[model samples]
Target: MPLVRIDLNQGRTAAQLREIADAVQEVMLDVFAAPPGDRYQIVTEHPAGQVIAEGSGLGIERSDALVMIQVFHQGRSVEQKTRAYAGLSRILAERAGLAPGDLIVSMVENTKEDWSFAGGRAQFLTGEL
Candidate 1:
């Protein structure tokens, strides 16, 4: 499973936030090949000034509608990640009316040994996942 964190400035309603989160989850499913119904996400909306997203000199415009996504998961290839980023940009724009220019994404990888679903056991190692 990929755990996704979506950080954006505070202006959207709860339904809108869920739409953004769902958009991220869609990328996890389609591009990252995560299993269905394995969604895990944290959507945090900061006050307008709290989220400072710069254009990174790429000239991509930043806005309060900026969406920063960090995905934590295991063993996805570079190609998968590349597609995931593209998919997020496209899907978020389609589903949430978010500008592709206003999106930023990052991924972090870990091993199965690093995850414990419950009971202090590594579910992947224990064949419980």
Candidate 2:
């Protein structure tokens, strides 16, 4: 289970946002192997200057289209993470017209105990997942 958070500069149309989010979901499914229909994402649009992402000496530049994606989920292997990153970069460019430099992705790993699907219960821990 991966809970994705997409933060982007406020300018894109609704269709653009949907395309970007769907592209990410595709990567999560194809690369991360998330279960079917387990899609969970939160997309937040911020005004200009709200999201400041600068290249850390990589000589890369970011524009208003910068999209920051954070995935919180159970531990995934390094290979999976690498594939996910590459897939996101490639697929977003193809499907959403997002520049590779304008994208930032990060992953946080946790145990099943960290999740609570609904009803105030830790579904994964209670065998409800």
Candidate 3:
């Protein structure tokens, strides 16, 4: 599952969020080859005053958006992860209406033993399981 956290300047509508989701889903599907039916995303909007940016030590100025995407998967190689991050960053920059340097993505890979789903009732035993 991919947990996407999008932090944008507080002025976006529901339609904007949906559009971002669509663009992100497309990147996930095309770059990571993730199944269309198997994807998860969470979009969070933060005001400029609350978030602490990297360079400015302040919230994003202007109409900038801070996107922090975290991806979780099993048995993925470094190359795959790299490609996923790169593809996502590129797509978000190109399609999500963000500056190229504004998007930041992080990924964490784990074995099947690390995660549980379905209210902790089911553990992912393998990629297929």
Candidate 3 C-alpha lDDT tens digits along 1-129:
544555566676888778777787887777667667666777777777665457555563433566656666667677777887777767766776777556666677666676665565434664454
Ranking according to TM-score, highest score first: 2, 1, 3
* Ranked by lDDT, top first: 2, 1, 3
Give the winner by lDDT: 2
Q: lDDT winner between 1 and 3, please give it.
A: 1
How good is model 1 by TM-score? 0.95
TM-score of each: 0.95, 0.95, 0.74
Q: Is candidate 2 or candidate 3 better by lDDT?
A: 2
Off by over 4 Å in 2: none
* lDDT for each candidate structure: 0.86, 0.92, 0.67
**Per-residue lDDT of candidate 2, residues 1-129 (tens digit):** 799999998998999999999999999999999878889999999988999989999998898889999999897899999999999999999998888799999999999999887789998888888
Q: Whole-model lDDT for model 1 versus the true structure?
A: 0.86
Model 3 residue 1 CA deviation in Å: 1.5
Tens digits of per-residue lDDT for model 1 on 3-97?
88888898898998988887788889988888888788988889878878887788888877888888899989999999988898898889988
> Clashing residue pairs, candidate 2?
none
